[model samples]
Target chain A: MKKVIGLWFALVAVALIGMSAVQTEPGLAVGDTAPDFTLRNIDGKMVSLADFPDAKGFIVTFTCNTCPYAVMYEDRLIELHQKMAAKGYPVIAIQPNDPEVQPGDSFEKMQERAKEKGFPFAYLLDEGQEIYPAYGASRTPHVFLLDKSRKVRYIGAIDDNPQDETGVTRRYVEEAVAAMEAGNEPELTFTKAIGCTIKTKKKG
Target chain B: MLKKAIRILGVVGALSLSTFLAAQEEGTPFPFTVYETYADFAPVMAQDNDTTYVINFWATWCKPCVEELPYFDSLHVNVAQKPVKVLLVSLDFRRDLTRKLVPFLAEHPLKPPVAVLLDGKYNDWIDKVSTEWDGAIPATVVYQGGKRIFHGEQFSSYSELTDLLAELKQ
Candidate 1:
């Protein structure tokens, strides 16, 4: 009886470990082919990576309306689109927050924000909150820069400084794009920044 | 007459200054000590004490962070007799220190010590806090002696937090 109970406990422990391993699957890393997505743009039109055929690469940024960090980067994102879009790397902003969880990031609010800021990029909504998780984006304003072939070239923050734009010493995304343009791998592929967690309903 | 007017102005200026200082003293002082760099704040994460340290990385702007804050407070209160300490680390922007954070803290006072980490070079030190952390707010680190655990998500309830502490205590 004691032996049977010990065996049962070991099996339970192994099962729990397996379950946790599956749950903590890491997000897309550098060199991985980013999964193509067709999400809804703020203009009520569906946009996909396929839409930008002339693009050399993409600045696929997972950002939303509500996060203060995301809000701080809005102007910088517009500037990135203006400079990089013409260079064949367009900024594709995606709202990853669930509206039910954070109403401020709803599709309608996104449209309003984009319009107010005169955003020159496509502000897409991850409607079912599916694309972000697939890309393994855990926070708002997370960047997953992809090459023309949809291969992730760099994954991380836009710049070193999140608060003061004038104080920025390292522009991670721009540097990554420049490196790709030069046909060289980004020297710093991964960076981190403090950001709000993507809002989603708590699971049972 | 001109000299007397100058004297009167000086007296008025001094009176207003005293009033301002008095108001500041009477008001609730800003609760958190602001650390400008990760290097300055690194010691808090590396404390090698026998007491269990429950440090929660949070910000005033994060919704989930705000929601889970009460649980940390509850944990602090419940574990008063135990060798456990709870610290709330605020990642609020330094610009908001006077504007948003002070007012928020004034309205909703927390029992635990709150420290504001204003380090913008997150990639430099996020791994130092916890490699499992993806630089998300509300991430928590619970440690005692040589053992440590990092939770990258919000705690659902007070019991959930207590349970983690209980496990760490053993």
Candidate 2:
């Protein structure tokens, strides 16, 4: 019995230690300056948030390949990216979940997904997850929108509802973009995202 | 045709059962006990005379919480010398206590003290835990000397756990 307890204790200890390794510098909220990062896109082109400067705004969604919810929202993700990009508000989908831990989320697979879906936006890898915390993204499909000045104007879920598109009570990302286009502060600034938690790759 | 349908149903049933059983077996894997009652949480923290507590509230359906469980279990073992107590309070429904949870913990062979919180009302207990919390999954608090520090969201690093422990020890 004692041995059994000890083994279980060891397992829980391992899990907690793993949890702590994720260095969260908290997140940038409304009025906070956006953090810049250079990451590789599916096309192997160098991409940076700074590249989007002079644009009206940008939608940065922390997304992954395989979470059921993330996968379910693919079409909307595509639509949102295209719809906003047409209006000079581009979308940059960054995958913060570690690919080594989740093999399907690997950069190679990401390239395949981008090719398969003809991704309208840059699907970048947040290598080492350095830039995700600046936006406080803990889940795939989380979104943060930055205005022309590089100040975060809106943050939160991609939409109000996840399971049912017909029941979406709030169009957070869309409204934020509309608010910017109309020269107004986004009425709703943030909401807890509805999606999979980021699976930061386990370290040795 | 009937046999084929039954065979298909049986295969699906077996797969689901195995998955269900798999979840319950790994629920508790730490030495310190986890109490599930919300009323008991503050009191337990209040009762410990010379111990620091790393209290984590999680659910099986919560991915980050699940991913981070093994780290807490490890802390329970390694820091037993600091003799810090670790508690894992599962936010899963009481209905799954016996059928799903207990079995899951048993399979994972959790060592920590585990408790199943029965509070169904998030509104009542949400403020009690912390006012800043917005009812998100994977919430954790490390308490020492009667002071509480809250950490929300999933964490997955041993160094982060150690650093928090080191600060509380000071």
Instruction: State every prediction's TM-score relative to the real structure.
Output: 0.87, 0.58
lDDT of 2 by residue, A120-155 (tens): 899999888788876788667778898877799887
- Measured with C-alpha atoms, the lDDT of residue B70 in candidate 1 is 90
- Model 1 CA deviation exceeding 4 Å by range: A1-26, B1-29
What does the lDDT read for residue A127 in candidate 2? 86
lDDT of 1 by residue, B63-146 (tens): 789999999888888889988999999998887877777667655668899999888888899999988899988899999877
What TM-score results for chain B when candidate 1 is compared with the true chain B? 0.82
The deviation in Å at residue B117 for candidate 2 is 12
How well is each residue in A90-166 modelled by candidate 1, as lDDT tens digits? 99999999999899999899999999999999999999988998899989899999998999999999999989999
Which lDDT tens digits does candidate 2 get at residues B27-141?
A: 6332223455567665755555667888788766666777789989899889878858888877765455666665566456566777666544344466677666555568878
Q: Lowest-lDDT window of 10 residues in candidate 2 chain A? A: A193-202
